[model samples]
Target: MRIAIVGGGISGLVAAYRLRTRLGADADIVVLDRAERLGGILYTGDVGGEPLDLGAEAFVGRRPEVPALLGELGLTDQLVTPAGRRPLVWAGGAAHPLPPRTLMGIPSDAETMRGLVDDDTLDRIAAEPDRALTWYPDGDQDVYSLVADRFGAQVAERSVDPLLGGVYAGSSRSIGVRAALPGLAAALDAGAPSLTHAVAAALPPPSDAPVFGGIRDGYRVLLDALADAAAARFVTATPATRLARASRGWVLDPLGLVDAVVLATPAPVTARLLRYVAPKAADAAAGIELSSSVVVALSLPQDTALPDNSGILVATGESLRAKAFTLSSRKWPHLAERETALVRASFGKFGDEAALSWSDADLIAAATEDLATVTGAVIDPVEAIVQRWPGGLAQYAVGHVDRIAEIESATAELDGIELAGAYLHGVGVPACVASGETAARRIAESLSAPAKS
Candidate 1:
């Protein structure tokens, strides 16, 4: 049987690997990507003669998918965790400790937001539990609307927006409560008295495990390993233009007829691929917007006096051009051994695409300037590398859950087609890994079924 997996991102790569394992030696699988290289946004570039991830550098370790995948690939030795350091939030012209016991920066109580917000905002938060909250069951809205209305705009801007910006590359205004914070939404739907109570109920139980994980070298190691294991024909710098029903199965452009196909491209690309085969799914997917981002990696002198914290997140309305700074040398213990200290400054957001057009020199200059402002340290970079990811992240806007449900329902009727990507369920590495494997399993099962007489 022949299978085509479109898009060479992590989701598509993982799907190809899973399909290889399930189908064994005889099955033919081809992986196609429009880019010259694979890994999609998970690109690793060099800085100061050492490999550093220019895209996502870490994954949520609390999830099992990443660790489990590493073990399967015998690359568990590459799995590394953070140094157990807390990240600070830069707001009000200073850096403050990131609030504790909060779900994505929505504090369970007023005290968690004490230093970050003003006294008036603190008073508002303290009294929030007593206010009557109006939340309809199974309803949805932007996170900013809910947090700002219930706890004052300061909480949403200073505390919540920074964290959301780091995750979605978009503000709370572009993310929805139901999809971004399902537990909190469930708590509200279950009739929680106030936002405070809902946040309290939704918070996960505390644990000592590291909250995030990364590869010791870079994501390139995993990408290389997955590619080798999948053993599929890799087609780079080529895009699959069309997909349609065929006599026996399906015809994927450039790849010809295949027993099955998995479209692991981004939301917009996936929507286009499904336009004729599944119009409803395509409509829902087309409504899902994307956000762009840029990462500027700076190699600094090892003796630079950066903060002891893991990283710094910028609050909304900050004058700095950068949104966040990941002190790679401080965040990852494995990177501390490098010759020069490493820092990754992120730029752009959902509606802000200006950084994407900036020259590498300009991006590096902005990163250097912003790092100085946030860290209050001498800014001198030994070397720098800039990577741009336009329309890289999917915005989980209001009614996102309903849209995903609609997309899935409409595509479920197809016999030999599957969809997987960061847009459907989540934007994290673990979520993408799971999506790919799930898609592979479903397609393998359908193809393995006996034909009706």
Candidate 2:
């Protein structure tokens, strides 16, 4: 069997690796990436002698797949936790620590909310006289509005929206939290009562495994490891322009060719290829618009006095240096220089595209200025690094899941066709890996299914 994997990002790489693990070269595999690089969003750069994460900075503990996979790959020693005390919810000129006993940002006791909580909002949420709940009445609802309705518009506007943009690099108005946060969504639907109470019962206990870990060297280490383990050959810089169906299976040309192709690129690119194969599916795929974001890393002076392990998230109306900044040195000291502080700040989400339009020097200056106001730090950065990812984040709109299911079902009739990437399942790195693994498993199992009887 000859399998062609499209898009050499994390998803494609993982699928190829997993196929090799299960099939042991029973099939010929090749990975094609348009860019000359791997680890699409796992980019890391060196700024002023310090390693900086240009893409995602940290992984949450609740997601165990990442840590477990790292351990399996012999990367146990690379685990590093952000030194920040706790992520803050910045809103209405105040930054409030997430109340204790809350799960998934849902406060167990709404009355305990500080600073930004309002009596009217609390009354609206707590009043259950005319309350009615069902299995998420609508399968398609914006996650932002749901949070705003249940947790107060302040929480949604200040905390949830920015965090979603931070995590997904997209707009929250179109995201469906139920799919993004399935566990919490399920608990809510199960009648745990109140977003706060439901969340407590929803999340499971923590794991002994490091919640999150990257290679001590960097994300490239993991990508390189998987590349070496895959049976698929990799062709970098060979962009597949079009994918046409063949009488035998499928001929992927400069466009795409192969028995089956696993597209792991961004949603828009994926849609373009899928259009010729399945038009309806292409529309669904294209609907998931990707958002662009920019990350700026600054190295502060040695004399800078900063809170130890404290990272701050700016409220919506906060100074517009950028959306948020993480005290890199304080959060992950292992990656920082002792004499100087390192900070990673992000600017540019849906409506904030103009933020990245500025020159690197100006953007860094702006970011530093914002940090000065939030942290009261008075020092110029020694070195600065800025990275921009265009259309990298996937937006999950209403009926997204159904559209995906339909796509999967639509492509099944066409043998040697498989879809694997963040757009299909979850969008996080761990989930990306899982999505790849699952797609590969499906491909492998069908191959061994006794010729479909």
Candidate 3:
């Protein structure tokens, strides 16, 4: 009845909680984490005498996982939405409204990209439908390649990179077409004549529902609830050194024998752990690269003359160190009540880990300077907090879908062993939650099945 869950991030926590529910109080579940605290990247820190998320502050509201989980936990009261302000893209040394009717910054028509890209690029976009397209049904390529070749490089770098950079902490050049924009990929695979037409087909239908949701007190509220409900033995500051098969089930290092084990860790760590048991899966995981990022939260005077927009996304080749700035006070109504305005400046991306080495003071200085540069506001911070996430995000590079398939197929026969993490299907909180719950359900079903005669 003993189960060992490795990695204490949201994925591992969700797995443990689901396991407790499926097996009841009698089942012994142990959650192990190398960090002193749980919740993985979903960390909430104190700033200006209040809670603020240092990692991911929000989730896609249209996705049912997060909102549904809150309801089940009776924490729906903590749910909150944005103030409905659109973000601006910082390009050509100025701010412009984010183009509408685009799929991840790929505009459906040339008119939408007006004022953002030059006349030549816009004209190219308008005439793209007449251009012949070559796409294989199952082939994949980087987003930059697809967009830059069809539209001009301006559309890929200025229009698309900002949005893709925010999502993957990587540029369009680093992200793949199929994994990041499946709908667009499908349209191309289905013989769309051009990129413009494919983008139009891929775009979701307009909806009144808010694009994102967040917890009022920060992600800590959700983390605390999951930990309490799981009621598992919490083992912190410990890593699972090795994993091997046992006579009856499996043997997880430090935790000893267990009926089941879930490796809800990052790709690199997961690869290292599965080296012997599932070498193919390990190799596949090892190929999945990671991206690092740093978040610097600054608290300023509430009356600071910042832009009314929710945030500012920096275009590629911008002269600033920050890739984006989330104006917390303007974006979230719950945070507007605070005496000081809140802003989050993000740094680093795939193949760029320089920010991780920056001192807290340096990061704060950069965030302040960059905020001033982007927002045209006075650069004075009442308080600041810096959090570094080394290899926090997994790059869904070209052929990522096939890599995931290889990993999953290789591990399908390993009974009592499961895998879950942000690297699997997606890097978002909702996807991680789904991955953990899936692993838990599989484990529960395997255990509940009758033994062979």
The best candidate in terms of lDDT: 1
Compared with the true structure, model 2 gives a TM-score of 0.89
Q: Write the per-residue lDDT of candidate 3 for residues 25-137, one digit (tens) a residue.
A: 99999999999999998899999889999999999988899999899999999999999999999999999999989999999999999999999999999999999999988
Q: Give the range of the ten consecutive residues with the poorest summed lDDT in model 3.
A: 370-379
* Higher-ranked by TM-score: 1 or 2: 1
Model 2, position 163, has a per-residue lDDT of 64
Q: How much is 362 displaced in model 1, in angstroms?
A: 0.8
In Å, residue 216's CA in model 2 sits off its true spot by 2.7
Q: What's the lDDT for candidate 3?
A: 0.94
Q: What is the TM-score of each predicted model, taking all chains together?
A: 0.99, 0.89, 0.99
lDDT of 2 by residue, 1-453 (tens): 778888888888888988888778677888889888887878878876645667876665667766776777777777666543556655666556644454444455556455556777667556522355444634556666766666667656655666676666655576776666777767776766566566667766755554444445567667777788884678888888888888666888763446667777777887888888888878877777667778888888866876554567665556565777777776665755466777888887765678767898888888888777766668588888889877767766667777778777777776667787877787778878887887788777766666542
lDDT of each: 0.94, 0.71, 0.94
Model 1: runs farther than 4 Å from truth? none
Look at candidate 1 and give me any clashing residue pairs.
Answer: none
For candidate 1, lDDT tens digit of each residue in 1-453?
A: 999999999999999999999999889999999999999999989887788999999999999998899899999999999999999999999999999999999999889988899899999999999999999986899999999999999999999999999889999999999999999999999999999999989999999989999998899999999999999999999999999998788999988999999999999999999999999999999999999999999999999999999999999988999999999999999899999999999999999879999999999999999999999999899999889999999999999999999999999989889999999899999999999999999999999999756
